[model samples]
Target: RDIAPSDVLAAREAGATGVVLEAGATNSHALILARSLGLPAVIAVAGLLSSVTDGDLIEVDGNSGEITIGETVPASAPVAAGRATPSATRSSAPPVTRTTDGRVVRLYANVGQTADVGVALAAGAEGVGVVRTEFLFLDEPPSEQDQYEVYREMADRLAGKPLVIRTLDAGGDKPLPYLPVAPEANPYLGLRGLRLSLAHTEVFRTQLRAILRAAVHGRIMLMYPMVTNAEEIALANEQLLAARTELAASGEEAGDVAVGAMIEVPAAALRAEALARHAAFLSVGTNDLAQYTLAADRNNAAVSYLYSQTHPAVLRLIQATVTGAHRRGRPVAICGEVAGDVDALPLLIGLDVDELSVAPHSLERVRAAIASLSYPECVARTEAHLRDV
Candidate 1:
C-alpha cells in the first residue's frame, strides 16, 4: 500500500533499514523522504504483500528491485551488484557547476526536514531549493511557534544559504488528519495547495507568519504551490501582507522574504508571463506538470507510459515557462524528479533553467553531468527537440 511522508519518517525513527511499497510513484513524497533519510526503498512491487509473511527472512535489493525469501541468506552476497560504496576519500563537487561553454547552473537540494539540511550542505548543495512543509502538518497542525522553531532551525543550519520554504501543500494526495477535507472524485484537481490555503486563511496566515519570523534567522524564500493564475498569487500575497502586518503590530521582528510561485499546472505554465509579474521567481514542478499536461495519472501504472517529462508537449511548456519568466528577469528553477535525472540534464540546461533542486543523494551526479555538457550543444539539442512542435 502507499505510504505517507510522515509514515516514512516514523519508520526511520523505528530503526527500519529499508522500505518496500506495493504502490507509489518514484517521485512521491514518501519515496523522497526515504531517499532523504537514506533508506533503501523499492516501490510498485506487485504481489509484495501476498507473497510474504512476518519473519519470512526476505532479502530486499532496492537498486535491483529484487526480493529473495529463504530461511537464511549468504552474508557475503552483495545487495547491490556493481554499486559503488560510499568512500571517505571521494572528492566533493563544487556547490555551483559551470558548463564547458561557461554557462552557470546552481544545484540545490530538496529537503523534507531540518535534519536533511546538514546532509544537503555536505553533499555540496549551493542552497536548499524547496523545503516540503507538509511533513509538519501530517499528524496535526503545528502551532505557529512550533512551525517557527522548525523553519528557524532549518534557516539557521543553512548558515546563510538561500532556503526556499514551500507553504503547506496539503488537502489532495496528502491529507492532514486534523483538517477536514471533503472527499472528491479527483483529489488532484480539487482544492489543494494555494486553494486549500485560501480556503483556510487562518492556517495559511499562521504558516506565512512563521516563515516571515524565520526569515530573520537566515536567507529565506517563501514559495506557494499550485498557483494556476495571477489572481491566486494576488490572493496569496494579500494573506502574506496580512501576516506581515500582524507580526509588526505584535512587535515581532520579521525580515525580508522573496515570494515565488510553483508552476505545476499547464494553465500556469501557459500564463507564466502573468505569473512572473506577480512572483519574484518561478519554479517548475515537472512531476505534476507532466501528469497534468498529459492527462495521465502519475501513480497509475496503466497510464504510466504516457507520463513523461521529455514529451514535446511537456518540454514546450517548460520552455514557455522559462521564456516567460526570463522576459520579466525572474529566475526559473526545476525542482522535480527530472531535475536530478542525468539524461534530462542536457534538456533542462538547453532550455535555460537557472537552478535544479534535487534530492541530496543526487547532487554529485547532477553536478558531474552539468560539468560534462556544453551550453551551445545543449541549446542546439533543445532546439532540435522543439523543432517540429
Candidate 2:
C-alpha cells in the first residue's frame, strides 16, 4: 500500500505496527516520518503491493533494506556489483580502518536520510561523509526547531564520529512542489545546489542554525554542494557567520564548526587549490562530475553508458582534486556512487581519496574489499594509468 507521511500517521492510528511501501517513495515526506516516528519500513521492491494481499503478513527489515513476504524468505538480498552480503563476507576481518598493506582509508557512509544513520553505523561507517539534507525535506521544509531536534538526535547518536552535512541541494531534477522551480532548458545546468540555496537565504539560514545547534552534541562539519567557485563558498560562509551571530545573541552554544566545499563542478575541481585555501576540507562528487564532464545525464539510459566514474577524463578531475587537497593539507572525501563501487576502489585509493563514502548497504562489502587491496600496488598502478604528460 502507498504510505504517505499522513498515511504513516493514519496507519499508526489504526494500530498498524509498520509499513511496506513501493521503493520509489522512499524519499517521500511520509517515509521520512515513518522512520522518525520509529516505524519500521522496507522500500524499493518490485511487485511489492501485488505480492501482498489485504492483511497479508510481511516482514520489513529496515536495517538490511529487505522485505519478506508472508513468512517466505526473499529469494535474494540486494548486493553491490561483484560483491556478497557484508555478513556473509565478514570473516573475522578487523574492524579497524586500514588496508592489508597498511594504508588507512576511512570508510564513511553517504546517508540519504536521517533514519539511514543507524544502518550506516551498524554497517561500520567510521564517520558520515555526507548526509544528503535534501532527503530530510521532501514535501516542504521543516520548522527551525523541528530541523534542530532531528539533527540533534543524529549528532547525539553519532557520539563523536565526524559528521559532514551537505546543506540542502535542491532544484534541477529534484524540484520541490512546495517551492516553485522554473522550467529549465537544462535543469542540471541551471539554478541547483548552492545556487538554489542562495536564492532562498532565509531557508538556508534556518538550516544553518539547526546544524549549528546540533553541532553541540558532537563533531559536525558544514559543507555546501554544487559550488562552482570561491565566491559562492565565500558568500555561503558569510551567511553561516550570520547564523552563528544570531545563535550567539539567542544564547545558544554551537561547537567549533569546520567548513567544507564540494568539488563537483569541473570549474571547482579545476581550481580546487584556490578553493581549498578557503575551505577546511574538500569533497569530490563524482556522480555529478562524471555527468558534467562527459555531457551525459546519468538518469537517461541513452547516455547511461557514458556516465562512468572510470572514464579517463573524470579520473583526471578526481586526481587533480585529491592532489590539490593534499597539497593544502586538506583531506578529500568522495561521496558519490563511485565511492561505493568495488571496481573504482583501487583508482580512488590511487587518487588518494582520504575517505570513501558509500551507500549504507554497501559499506561493509566495500570495507572488506579495501582490506584486500594493497595501497602500494594501487598507488603505483594509478600513477602509471593516470600519468600526466
Each candidate: how many clashes? 0, 2
Per-residue lDDT over 251-362 for candidate 2, one digit per residue giving the tens place of the 0 to 100 score: 9987778999988899889898989999999988887888899998755544666777778789899888887888899999988777767878998898888888777777
Tell me the tens digit of each residue's lDDT in model 1 across 182-250: 889999999888898899999899999999999999999999999999999999999999999999999
Misplaced by over 4 Å in model 1 are 70-92
Q: Which ten residues in a row have the lowest lDDT in candidate 2?
A: 77-86
Instruction: Please list the residue runs of candidate 2 whose C-alpha ends up more than 4 Å from where it truly belongs after superposition.
Output: 1-95, 387-389
Taken over the whole model, the C-alpha lDDT of each candidate is 0.86, 0.78
- TM-score for each candidate, following the candidate numbering: 0.93, 0.79
- lDDT for model 1, please: 0.86
RMSD of each: 3.3, 6.8
TM-score (C-alpha, index-matched) for candidate 1: 0.93
